[model samples]
Target: MTSRDTDATTDATTDAAAREHATATTAATGPAATAADAPVTISYEEIDGARIAVVSLNRPAKLNGLTMAMLRGLDDAAATLRRDRDLRGVIFAGAGNSFCAGLDFGSVLKKPMDIVKAFAPNPLAGDGANLFQRVCWEWRRLPAPVIAVVHGHCYGGGVQLALGADFRVTAADARWSVLEAKWGLIPDMSGARTLADHVGAEQARWLTMTGRELSGAEAVEVGLATETTESLDDAHSRARETLRELMGRSPDQLAATKSLFNHAWRSPRATFRAERFEQAKLLLSENAARARTAAMKKTPPNFVRRGTWAFGAKKK
Candidate 1:
């Protein structure tokens, strides 16, 4: 991104909060989205000039697989970001030993139809995207930049979720994969858009079909994870450092610039059009063939693991 104007002296804590207030403007413009309209359980940390929200999958028992509560949390966070007057940017990360393990298999096992329905957007019924998707999309809609820091395991839905951010930082040993194929599903959680931005159609097909895992290092190479840190701690530290640098710049300029770059990629019309084009092909099955086969056979999908674990690796 090009350099922007700012007051130079960054009162980050204050400026970011003010931007949140500006985002709040949407709250009044759009129809009221009551508690009933909320998605799920992701939580947040409101910063002065930005938001450092940690939207955890919260089901650590399920390795933080997604849930309706998590989805509601994502929407609520987006609403807050939307209504906020001073927010300038956002940071999307996760909690626990693993970032997120994707959807909860146990939940699916117990209530397959219900669980699947929850992930569906139901455009005809008014909701067009689910919580897992917004965790990624809302960040893109923000006028300011968003950064995702990944650690531990990020698979299936989780892998696709990170694709939404403007930048990402991943732990060197973090497990990465388009894991949905393992469960006889595809990356339908807004990942198609995010993944395509980084990789070509062919590469995207290969990654999703293989259910291939990637190291944090490999994630950066494939564009799923942006940067690989020696340790998770480093990923946070670097992200914070980058934020400080960004805060030092002008807020309006940064926000406007972010908007411009996003649009340069495509307008709302073009975006959905491309979405249809891609989904049309993927829905036909050239992509998920191998993943489905491997899942049913209960075999480990072909994936090349990278990274070495030495004693006490420093956290990024």
Candidate 2:
């Protein structure tokens, strides 16, 4: 064959392979989204020498409603963040006015089998969380803190998504609700864990059963939010301020702190044991010694980078 003919054949083969791969991936997950059509977008930057990941729900005309594509995009972003040890924090936001309205019931309701597939349990995941659950749960277990900047509507699945963050800063006029009850369902995502922890069991049950709307201020009062601002810019400012304060701490301590507090929600025996175990692990680290020296000298400590540390079976 002529060289030109050979190149044309090769190009055709590559195009066919790409199309096949895209089709398979879409079938396994859901719809495909290109940069122009994506429901979610993730970006990162270094702020004050700290790496911060930013995740945005980009379907604004529909108020950033949750779709399989958006969920998968978010899950993929969370997975990426989990592996980045240099990441100091994450800011979860939505493009345009709202963070997220809720599930796009219009699309999801038409795909019963797809819903089942999304929830298929995984044996390797100790908690039995499927794809739907991991999108939220992963944020909770992320090595760095996640701060959600909320504005406008945050209902149902949106509420669950925000709950996954360590701190949620919402605009005072933003709407918040536990809306599944209104749709004849329940908050089946990891919202249950976050709600039970943030608000006590009684309040969690009441809110879930009622599905009533709460203003951002009321959300803070009810323990569903960390703080409320006058506007979206204010929310971002608050998150940035919090991130700056957090950047001063050692990553090991931050991870250990999150783990220790998370353990607090468990049995007393487990909590105590985890406390001792985490302390022991941290105590043996060279970073801990550096921290001590820095404290004595009143200077910033140059501890070991986060991903470099390994502690027994805990090193995932």
lDDT (Cα atoms) of all candidates against the true structure? 0.58, 0.75
lDDT of model 1, residue 4: 11
- Residue 217 in candidate 2, Cα distance off native in Å: 0.7
lDDT for each residue of candidate 1 in 92-188, tens digit (9 for 90 to 100): 6654566666765544446666556666675763337765566667777665567777877788777776777778888898898887666566787
- Candidate 1 lands at a TM-score of 0.64
User: What TM-score against the true fold does each predicted structure earn?
Assistant: 0.64, 0.85
RMSD of every candidate to native, in Å, equals: 19.4, 11.8
Q: Write the per-residue lDDT of candidate 2 for residues 53-155, one digit (tens) a residue.
A: 7777777667777777777888888887788877898888876667777788666657878888888978898889987788888888898999998888788
Q: List candidate 2 segments past 4 Å from native.
A: 1-35, 307-316
Task: Name the regions of candidate 1 deviating beyond 4 angstroms.
Answer: 1-55, 108-132, 264-316
Give the Cα-based TM-score of candidate 2 against the true structure: 0.85
Lowest lDDT block of 10, candidate 2: 1-10
